[model samples]
Target: MAGVLLSAAVACVLLAGAASASSSSPRVFTVGGVERGWRQPAPGEETYNHWATKNRFHVGDFLHFRYDKNDSVLVVTRDDYKRCGADRPVLRLEGGEARFRLERSGFLYFISGSPGHCDAGQRFTLRVMAQRDNGAASPTEAPAMSPGGSFNSTPGSGSGSTRMPPRGNAGDGKTSGAAPFGAYHAVGAALGVGAALLAFAPPLPATISDPPSTAASFPAASPMASRLRLGQPNPNPGLSPSPGERKGEEGEARKPEPRREVTDLGGGSEVVHIPRFMSRETAWEMFEHLDKRIPWTRPTIRVFGRSVVQPRDTCYVADKGLTDLRYSGHQPHAHSWDDFPVLKDILKEVHEALPGSHFNSLLLNRYKGGSDYVSWHADDEPLYGPTPEIASVTFGCEREFLLRKKPTNTKSQAAGESGETARKRLKASAPQQHSFLLKHGSLLVMRGYTQRDWQHAVPKRARAASTRINLTFRRVLP
Candidate 1:
């Protein structure tokens, strides 16, 4: 009893002041504090060091970076920083912009992953002051210029617990996974005193001498709210029954119960986005498996009386018996859902989320990298009936998902319209647009007249340095 009381006293003393620091809102600091973003500074420049000296970094603060498409940010070791390369990084984020959270304390080195950028002085180092700062500590170093944001993610609304996309750039704008640090803290209120003891423990190392000790886990795909996110993890990652076993699926630990948000885009149209529909781990695993297994091909599509290959690779899989299915003047070879066990499990979850959703067809799209994109258009095909609920799941990397309200006059629109006509409508005038950063393991569901009223697109982002796979589940009517 005496020992327990003594432990409690020590814990109380350690935590007495942390209540406010741990709960404080994290600060976001743009790397180098420069206008040119994360490009290399002048030869052997001092701006990065000057910037580091100017900032007061604490754990939980975010480091934001902006850079070019071909460029990348790397979380490197002290040796790598000196040698001008990171063969093994603590983390690597890509895109035009990115944000990273300082999970713990100690020195952190960041450098450019691009060939010569680091040698030319496109890097910085930071020392996260202990989290228990009393406004009287030695000046600290600032974060390096690297982005590949973790989900929980820009330092995202929370997958890497994390983005600065040029993306999640190890900050260029998309997000990554590794948010368990913040994810665990986000639920701190629910955690008991035993967990708070960590506040006094040694801060996590910021140096990248080796790869991160833990695997990167992202909780994304669903918007944060009363929306449809993925199911939560199975209590703990190391519990008796695995998430797949508990849910009767073959996936890894499921994410939090995804949340869904409905948006009314006029014309009686409704669209929903569950940013956290699926956990990043499960979604990433699915992406890896599907990329190699799915028989993907660049189907030739007729555009405005001219034959042209589609911009991205695609595969059509469905629940058997639905022949005569075609899109854009081409009929893709049909595949069965049974071929991929992961698909079957994901489909089951979709059904559970939308009790009445009857989807039998799946269109798998693979965006090899930044260049692969789908031009603007609606999914208003006759085969899908007037109003269809199409559920879209994204895995691996992040991309811009755009939804635009159609022009008031459909004077030039036509059935089976493909190609230049779509561009004309978009270029005629800038239409009202809504953008969603499609993160890994996220779900976007379009129902009601969303397809008919709003045009959706995954536009080209040259700075996007990652591959992406999207699964659109639909119901084909006979």
Candidate 2:
């Protein structure tokens, strides 16, 4: 009985210690200190590197950036950091007074996203030291400002001096902690903790390294510069069993389904073809629902000096708050997305299949027969932003989708040529073209710089064809 009581007391003491350690406050460091804010370093003045080297940053510590709204922050790769390039940043933060927590135990790079700021010494590289066994605080605790303008620190802790630096025009000197740091925190905390605890953890050197090769995991395709080759066979074909069908019926041999296939188009362009993305029955049901229920319109555009009606019927559906979309001289008003539940469900499925791609608007096209088709053009509207991922879902008849590479020097070469002459030259010098027969119940995704380099169209077919409906999901930026 005495021994049992002693063990219980020891367990209680350990629990108390763990609770106390977990409550420790994360240290917050001002990016350029209180005097300078996030300005460029003066000649021979202490830069961010100088200040960072003076302190010991742990996984849970926060780096607070206070700057003007015009300036921005970019979390970039090591190569981008060295060149001060802002393109393709790993992460970007705009506005003033952003807080980034150091969640991993390796090197992290940051730079000013504003033009010329990075060149003027407004960048920093931080190395987070490995965490110790002294139970670190959870990454979720919101950083609240205390009366002394410092982050709230635990009572009787010596790290209380880490406070917000004074600013002349800073608003409220407080943060709501509403930033989307959850993803960063989770990734960092898991990696940091796991690396520290595991004896067989891979050696994480504190230097920039090349990205791991994904070639072994993915197949290769032809290297045609200006042509789209026929897409390869589906790697993992067939309909995945529905959730209800996946449950136990032990020892039942499941038939293999046709797999989705991805084809590389070079220049960071690719197409993902998903065979039978939806079951045949579901696809037909959706096609019938959209065809009968949608309020389709025949929009007109000025082509060849005449106001010609479009060849195909179209409808625009968008989220409730999005502005009307205008493309190719047609300003189409968007229908409320709530009116289309089937499309919303389809969009959800597309989102699940393609991670990181989010769609806010869908442009639906109805090709009544072989005669209805669209001309050559790229969906490169400014509203879609710089580079957009378009998820196109096809239902009904199969049609040949053609792609032709745009002339690289069209503008420069036509500088002195007449408009007609320039157009003729471009047609004569057009690069190799490619085509794909988009099947019913399949999906095609166009990614990367495809819009800037390629133009696509569905040419009219010579023979009679069944009605086809296409839903091209897009993200319209505010």
lDDT of 1 by residue, 98-171 (tens): 76666544557788888877765567776564343343233233333333333322332323312322213233
Query: Each prediction's Cα lDDT score?
Result: 0.65, 0.65
Model 2 spans with C-alpha error above 4 angstroms: 1-258, 408-429
TM-score of each: 0.46, 0.44
Model 1: lDDT to the true structure: 0.65
Encode model 2's per-residue lDDT on 1-478: one tens digit a residue: 5455444444443443343333234567777776687876654354565566545565456777777768877777667876889987765656566665553345577888889888776787765543422433333444644443343334433222233223221244323222123433543454444444333333323322211111010012232310132121322211233333332344332324447788777888777788778755356546655776678999898787788899999999898777678766788888876776667778988997788998999999999999999999898888887778998999999888888787566767877898799999877776768777888898988888788778889999976378999999999898
Say what the RMSD of model 2 is.
24.0
Candidate 1 vs. truth: CA RMSD?
A: 18.6
Error of 1 at 178 (Å): 30
Instruction: Look at candidate 1 and tell me the lDDT of residue 10.
Output: 52
* RMSD vs true structure, all candidates: 18.6, 24.0
